[model samples]
Target: MSGPAVRFDAVGLKLGGVEILRDVNLSVAGGAIHCLIGPNGGGKTSLVRCLLGQMPHTGNIEVDWGENRTIGYVPQFLDFDKALPVTVSDFMAMVCQKRRPAFLGLNKSNRRLSDAALDRVGLNGKRKSKLGSLSGGERQRVLFAQALIPSPALLVLDEPMTSMDEVGAAVFVNIIRELAADGV
Candidate 1:
């Protein structure tokens, strides 16, 4: 994908009078994998939020890209109603089906992409399973699957292994290697 380099300059964040981050600067080189490790409340996620433009912060975040600027994100967790009847395929369609309404089901191209993604994450067999019924690790795999549909140039994974089992972790490693090899 030949992803762009990301830079964070003098980033700072405060919420409810509590200083979450202050004067943080970072750089992620193109096609490089970077990890931000810290304690639970040390603002790692907050920093990510700032980078994703989901949080109000004082900083200059830049992505140096020539043309392709697609980004895929896999959050640490997703919270939804367990009673919702959303199946794994349904969720994938909702997220990956860009041209058509998700309620109408996945279009052919999106369906192929979703199937390949789920297969990469070792969740192909669970396509029809209810999202709420899957284990946490399975659900995490689903999240990872969704992010791979359009083949993003920049892939952001926050605590991607939080709930993954050993097998799932292995799959993740393989996928990461593949993505890196593809210049993503």
Candidate 2:
């Protein structure tokens, strides 16, 4: 909890007879903001995948956590049908609510939490709007909102600034600062 949140020792990855990552070594400290910078096909995403255990690799990857440590991830892409008629509120409810059945709908407390999270990302007014109608930036903000519901100790954001406009990016940076200040 107090030291490195993640440590990668001599990490190497290969796929289809090609080397993706080679001899990678790093340690990410707890409560610190770390960025992986590289060009396209530079193994940044692959490194993250390895850390998340989404891909197989060689070497030791260690995670240190306190009791009740939780992780929240916002992926680079969201794969959903563009024609789906799900509303933002409904989508949020599906992701944020754990105790309630989807058919049962969001409870009062869950609704409040979802609303607050949306408000943080300037998406409160669009809560009732259809998800398919949102712009790419708006959709990305909604993803950020979803990640804040449970407030994980470790938050992994992959290329979160990709589709964000100026205002959206500013809001994201501010929220990230606030989260870091709170030792998230």
TM-score for each of the candidates: 0.96, 0.92
Worst 10 residues of 1 by lDDT: 96-105
lDDT of 2 by residue, 70-142 (tens): 7777788678998988889989989977777655667888889889999999999998898989988889999
Which predicted model would earn the best lDDT? 1
RMSD of each: 1.1, 1.8
What does candidate 1's lDDT look like per residue over 1-184, in tens digits?
A: 5678999999999999999999998889888677898899999999888878899999799999857778889999989998899999999989986678777888888889999999989999999999999999999999999988877888999999978899999999889988888788
Top candidate when judged by TM-score against the true structure: 1
Task: Note the residue pairs that clash in candidate 2.
Answer: none
User: Given candidate 2, what's the lDDT at residue 39?
Assistant: 99
- Candidate 1 CA-lDDT value: 0.89
